[model samples]
Target: MSASTSAPANSAPVAHNALPPPSTSSAARSSRIAPHSHIKGLGLSPEGFANLDTAGFIGQNNAREACGVVVDLVKSRKFSGRALLLAGAPGTGKTALALAISHELGAKVPFCPMVGSEVYSTEVKKTEVLAEVFRRAIGLRIKETKEVYEGEVTELTPSESENPLSGYGKTVSHVIVGLKTVKGTKQLRLDPSIYEAILKEKIVVGDVIYVEANTGAVKRVGRSDAYASSYDLESETYVPLPKGDVHKRKELVQDVTLGDLDAANARPQGGQDIMSVMGSLVKSGRTEVTDKLRREVNKVVKSYVDQGVAEVVPGVVFIDEVHMLDIECFTYLNALLESPMAPTVIFATNRGNALVRGTTDVISPHGIPVDLLDRCLIVKTDSYTREQVSKVVQLRANVEGLKFGDGVLDKLAGEGEKSSLRYALQLLTPASILASLAGRTQIDIDDISEMNELFLDAKTSASMISESGAAFGS
Candidate 1:
């Protein structure tokens, strides 16, 4: 796929213009082709049969259209090497849509949310190290077959000179001290004693070794050179030298104060900090906090790098209540999003224009300029309709493994306008548990009545009275 080009700053949304209806023959042919070409793993048949009951589902047409746009961008290779953003209100399913797209792409998705403390805690040096680490991690070398060659070492030279003995004879002694290679290999000549020592040490043909000259200097001499015809008859091949060893990358290492690191590490090992935890729940229904936790998760996920593991799905970072994120966290996000493998970010908030009033200041605080926001596609999530609420209730009931009578869903859906899908799900959980306790096979109208009563009882009478008074007053 070609790299993504910059889109127009003020381009209008693509209009799905009217087209002539397909002919009967063409419709039949198209039906046999595929369901939705963009949506993968939905398990829909070629005729586009979806098991999801769409009777009560409403207002998702816009969301579906947005998803279609993303799919087209990917299919046309428009988003191949660029970052995209999805901004919306809380509970708008921005994350859900992004995840669906990621599922189709089969790419790695890094969920990074902005937090208050993370901003100032990340140091410049740490950022550099992280950059290098990320590069090495993603650009790991793959083992491949290549032709092997043998060559003679005419002379040995030390890259550094801290002359302990200074003279050429001394340097030569130090350089040739332990030179040894496989028998009959043309390389640096080695003494019989050194050859025997190397053999005893179990040095192999491909193994690299370092030789110390008599002058107290070190030089790399290849063992394979001894087999060359240029080598003296008494000479033996010299083993290749190994590269300098370095420590393995530390998972939890960060450029932050010791106290900050301690505080972060002290958080319950399984999850992230409270804010990020909440953000994750609000964003994408997943939570991970601290570099160590991320590493642990990555370890398990690495096995599915090119497989079906959902952990690697690209462009799926969901940040809820983004207004609450600290400046430092935003800065880190700005930098991270620029990375080629950065996840797609979905930032949701409720304050509307107030949250981003000072765009320049907000961007500057996070090291992201105004241009970044310009690239983000902002989508407003409208409130759910009555019909949508009914559908959500049924979907929730089905998910919780509750069998509800036909009219029971209608009763629950009509409770109040304030009730949302989330509330519906919450209500279903307790209702399902109670039904299980009661040994009931189905959640009939009686079950709904009991749940409603219990839900009412949980609230203070005074609060209920106030709500009633407010409703009447309105």
Candidate 2:
């Protein structure tokens, strides 16, 4: 027998647009979350800055002064931020000025260098690309706490095969290391190569060891105190001092890009394997950060900064060949610069009265809008003097690790002033090679003269072509 119950007269039918809440079972199951990419190790080196700051930089004093002003403004922490455009002829040190600005910013501020054309991506909107770049320049000072091993190695055993070759099977399976500390002793499984490093370092029983978290490089720190004291003073057997623990909880302050944080937040709360089970539903660069996530990230950043555990470091984005950017990208910059999270943008261009990309309109100075140009602190670079050009050539020769005989550098520098800085520098490599092949240890006057002839020949050929084209047109 079947009994049917009637629905309540006052109850309305369920709407098709309404959906039930996600099942607990579904939440428990693995997710198909997308993988995120991180932006790390994207900063200028101090050494590079030093290179540009050197006397070898030669000339461009006015340009150098402008760079110094920008650096001071960034460091003052009061200046919001502004765009800097370095306008100059090619080989007039436009790129060099931008690099110098980045260097002067130092380690505290992140320096991100990208070309003008890199802002567009088929996979993402131009605005989104700009957003990512803005985020990249803005960093998160993460005070991360991780559980790590820090102790001494008491014993090490390697599992090996008697046969030298195992055609069908794997040999030298794994190595087991016994690490000790004041608290207790722990056994760790290590790779064969790691064990080899321990042996190569002569780390035996009672030696201290630690594993690097980023790289699984087994480092032998030192011998145990008990083993060290047993050896007499000035003994032939050098007993190293006792090392710290190999495994222990660690607190580190690290700089991470906002992009890196966004990628990490994309991971499923349950696990990544669950996402694999969900199939490839999520593709790269498609992960969206919700407002809630932004609040959480901001909270963490603020907490650390308040606690003196971290500090907000401003960043730089140097766009070389800024004229290459289309009008759309250029228009996007106006708002990007004014955003509360804007970075110090340095743009370099050699173009004067050029057509903006994707448009028939020709722009003056640089292919950028006048409004954007007005906002920029323009720094102009001029041609180098003969002596200054010589200094630069000598400086470059030193940088490239090339040895030149007496008077050769001066001759090259004079030639560079006549041709171009780039042409002059380009001659050094071939000249050095020629000198080497001719049984010479260092480049001399003859090498310089020979390279000059080759450069003149190429210049002559280009001129001949231009002349022929003009005659043909007539």
Candidate 3:
């Protein structure tokens, strides 16, 4: 050891193994915690959302404008909370607009995407699913800093041995890494793979390293103190420091999901620490949560926020194909939309005047009930115009890394106007293949026309099979 090496003055090991003092009274030991969180600063700001533009939501101006209004209302918390319905024909950008709105609002609030049909899980009640969705949207992100041991690698040794867990002739190698620090010295037993990582980073005997507290990710931070004189600390000057002070503090941020909170609150007194690990295993909407439990969770959240250990972030619960929900789910939505605790619900559907599922009643516009529809800020997505369709095709082509000629775009736009935008986009791949087969990389009008006929033939065949109710060959 170097003559300058010594323990830090404040490096006395904390009494982490000590037992806690017992409570003297039953009242003191009561597990009940007082409600603390007053929900504030959760409201939206127009200035915070000023940069959010709907330019990415191409082809549907009405839908985009409607979403913009919803965004404004949701951000401002103006209307005491309401559902927004995006009603349109299939492939009319209803889902896109919903996603865009969520993305815009998500910058400040939590934006969680869920499907309507996900509530049908037989493992848990549908109401629980809805409750979890709402809870997840208003969860928190907690960050804590803790001091950790860190040092430069002084010596490394790799040794291989037969794997004890394996019956077969399998082998495993371990690397013993010796580190020198200002605080002291530590030797860590690590896998040989990690030793290779150290070597790959050119980390030799005198390179400083740190281990992340939460993730345990090891990284080379800087060169060692042994070469302090070789390089300048700052402004071409070498400043040497005493050895026993080389340590690092790791900041660990944990985004506590609703599931984690549930697990935490579910534990009995003195078992809260175990819940931290169990929280990651708990899936949202897996079990029914009672109103009492919800209240408890809210209290816990408030307490965490109040103590400055965590901050609550509002989230978006976007349920696409919302018309798939049964009447019972709709009933739940009716009550949820009126509640202040509810997250911003974005529902999108393609149904127009369909029978409400699990009921004899037929509904207008969508399968949704009238009361729920009234609560929703309804937005209708119209079929795309030819110009908009062209732009979308170009955008899609660029996204998919496809090359297309001007004539091809014009042809696709014309076809989209005659049929639907989805059908036009579907034809691009087949047309591209045809173009490639014809010794050309760029999709042209001829390729599109050929693919169009093929699409028509496939559609006709599908209709025939549906009508005949027989196998395709038969």
Candidate 4:
């Protein structure tokens, strides 16, 4: 051994091997969350409209551009009267386009999504259900400047006292919380109510929290960044040390959907007891909110908007399979779109000239009334090309953490071209299962072929059903 750089005479050989490393195997990290869970944004540049494969989206630049325009209109408050219609074939990413718009707008903007048949609830009037969704799509951003004790928690000691009402357990009289900011640290003798809030929030010594002085509300910001590099176990969201004094006036922006206000006012909770909560839950079983109560809530919301206490943020209401909404609901929707408190609406459908639901004689384009269609800016999403389908399949494989054997992806893409993109993507998981059963880690062409034979695509299934004489149309 070398003289100066030799190992210590008393050093144990396996001292560095104290703990095992984190697992990074495919089985450990694999997830089949959703087809579009990887979709984050519209996959476009912030300034120029650059068509690039980003945010798990492959193509459809035109639809994305139109959605971007709608997003712009939503932000500028000019998308009230008009609506955006996503007209496309199935699996062409219409819903994904709408979702991308909401993502582009940010999390504060409320985006209410519903199927057309959801309005056909037995308990509520169709118009009432539609009105509730419209209200939910609109957000009220309330800004409040309140005195809050905000800092990284250095110490959390709950002082306990004997309970006078119950002999079973002691009650927390007050909580001694030592809060530290960059400026200075302060100890707070908070109320017992605030201690309950702290327990509810799961606040620990390393967590950053803020206690509202007036309402006695406690909010956990996140864990302090000082302990971020300490260990790796459960996921940790580390935040920087709070700025300014431990006790300061912080301006908090609270976002609430209009439906939330209506519900709160309609069935106001009297107390925090189990009986009261149960009563509220039971009363909430009635789906419909009365029109008179909604009007009163609207008046209060308008006053709040007028007084500058809260600003109205109109968001998107995406109705998928909009053709299922009947003529009456469509009429109500037309009136709702023109209302002063209306939010931007986006419709999605795949129909061409077809019978409008609830109409025996009248045939409208896309199964929607001509009047509503005229008010919409139709953005068409094209079917995926063979190359695009291949790319999408590859993307899905990567997302699902599956290894593709030689020529497997090309074979799948060929199948996609023959049948449909949706059909091709559906075989991926089954093929992986087959490969696993055959003692192979990667899915080969044989696995793909076996899956193709076992499962029928939509087209093949339809053909079989037609042959069975089940009254299916050609």
Give per-residue CA lDDT, model 2, range 1-474, as digits (tens). Answer: 000011134543332223433555843664332111111121223422323335335667667776776777877864464688888988887766666566666656777778887767776676666666776888767675665665777768889765556466556668888877776777888787777777788777777767755566666656666665543554324334333554666776788877677668865555468667465455463655664775687677778778877767668888888988887888888888887657778899988888778788655568887778888888899988888788777777766668988898788777777778788887887776666545456787777776655556346678989999999999
Worst 10 residues of 4 by lDDT: 1-10
Model 2, which residues run further than 4 Å from truth? 1-56, 144-149, 155-250, 266-309, 452-461, 471-474
Q: Score residue 401 of candidate 2 by CA lDDT.
A: 65
Cα-based lDDT for every prediction: 0.44, 0.69, 0.68, 0.84
Q: Look at candidate 4 and give me any clashing residue pairs.
A: none
RMSD of each: 22.3, 23.6, 21.1, 10.2
- lDDT (tens digit, per residue) of candidate 4 on 302-370: 888888889988877999999999999988889999989888799999999999888899899999999
Model 2 global lDDT (CA atoms, 0 to 1): 0.69
State in Å the error of residue 99, model 1: 2.2
Once superposed on the true structure, which residue ranges of model 1 sit more than 4 Å away at CA? Answer: 1-59, 74-77, 80-89, 107-315, 355-371, 456-474
Q: Residue 109, candidate 1: how far off, in angstroms?
A: 5.7
* Cα TM-score per model: 0.44, 0.66, 0.63, 0.81
Give the count of colliding residue pairs in each prediction: 31, 15, 7, 0
